[model samples]
Target: MKTRQKNSVQGRTPLVLFLALYQLAGGLVGLGLCLKMIPALQQPSTSTWVGIVLAAVLYTFSILCGFLLFQVTRQAFLFSLANQILQVFSFGVTGLAYNYVAGLKVGVGVDFLTSWVFKLKFSLSSFTFSVGTHTGASFVAVNLLALVLLYLLERAKEAANV
Candidate 1:
């Protein structure tokens, strides 16, 4: 009996695997951040250092994730291109979602603290973070452009392979 080799060209297993791992890591980190933020928000006398540390951890994880994505995708031009494109979309959507969620969380936290911790009548007006609309749109555009470039690169690779 002879063993046959399977084709690796059609199905994007490597890409899928990389994406899954990235999402899993991101999800875990986000969950942890949410948990930390909620507790801090609930405590009226929470230390500013705690907030700073949490922000730093979130930033570090974000940077690490970007590096990991780049490392994983660099192995294949096609995958890299696709990822570069998808990253833009992902970032924009994630940013918007984060903004909305964070705002809600802050409001809830303030309310919880006022009612439970402080036992004072307090009304919080606004909570703001640095995410901007222009930034998200720019990221989306860049990703779309990268996808186009990746398509060209893949085509070139195919031609070369032939």
Candidate 2:
């Protein structure tokens, strides 16, 4: 019985690990882009400051979610699921449902098999991040994918009784 459980757990390891790595990379990429805006903060713009701070907070949560997923515990699954749900609401519903945010413009988007890449820009009127309001599709897809990842994590946890 123990061996069977071990095998079941091992079978899901690759998928969970991949998701963890993806989460970590996404967070890092997001934070790195946010860092680029730090110099712009020297200017006087409340929206810039607000946007940067909000993006940083969201990306930090992504990083934390990644770390929790690495633990592969039942609690981790639950926590990550919560985070994903939040992202879906924040990134998907607000981002796509309304179709736009004031003063925020979607830039050129480069899509990968599992990720999206876009240029980060700072200006007097607008600021953007690599993962910012570049593409509604990317945000929608990523948020949905995150939920799927959490589902898989839950399965892995159940398989291992963890």
Candidate 3:
């Protein structure tokens, strides 16, 4: 008897595993955001609701990726692609959503697209730590880099196998 390989693509296992771990990490971050939102839920601000909804979506994608990427199966490739695309877009969309929410809170967005929206109207105090500050953008940038690295690693591994 011989050990059978599913999908006959063992070389692609690293891509699947890396995507799963990355998605799991992102999902954990979403969980953290959700935990933070618990106390704020009492007030139920627009931003808080946005955070909750985004976290839910993130968790769903994370679970899907983690489960599907565990084995080098036929559908693992599709799930890996799904995970990467979701993270990449989620990061960008989350930033925009946060900006929109921040602008609305500060009387700037949707109703009026003013320079104040571009400016950091989130927090004017000495503590430069605000929720809607460029955090979403930074998150998106980080995920994009992860996707690029994943691609490079996959290509290099495939070449090495060849």
Q: Best candidate per TM-score, number?
A: 2
Determine which window of 10 residues in candidate 2 has minimal summed lDDT: 97-106
Weakest ten-residue segment in model 1 by summed lDDT: 99-108
- Better model by TM-score: candidate 2 vs candidate 3: 2
Spell out the clash pairs found in candidate 1.
Answer: none
Candidate 3 yields a Cα-based lDDT of: 0.44
Question: Which parts of model 1 have CA positions greater than 4 angstroms off?
Answer: 1-12, 43-162
Better model by TM-score: candidate 1 vs candidate 2? 2
Displacement of the residue 39 alpha carbon in candidate 1, Å: 0.8
Models sorted by lDDT, best on top: 2, 3, 1
lDDT (C-alpha, whole model) for all candidates: 0.35, 0.53, 0.44
Residue-wise lDDT of candidate 2 within 36-56, one digit each (tens)? 758765664675577677777
- Give me the candidate number with maximum lDDT: 2
TM-scores for the candidates: 0.27, 0.55, 0.49
Displacement of residue 83 (Cα, Å) in model 2 is: 2.1
All models, RMSD in angstroms = 15.5, 9.9, 9.8
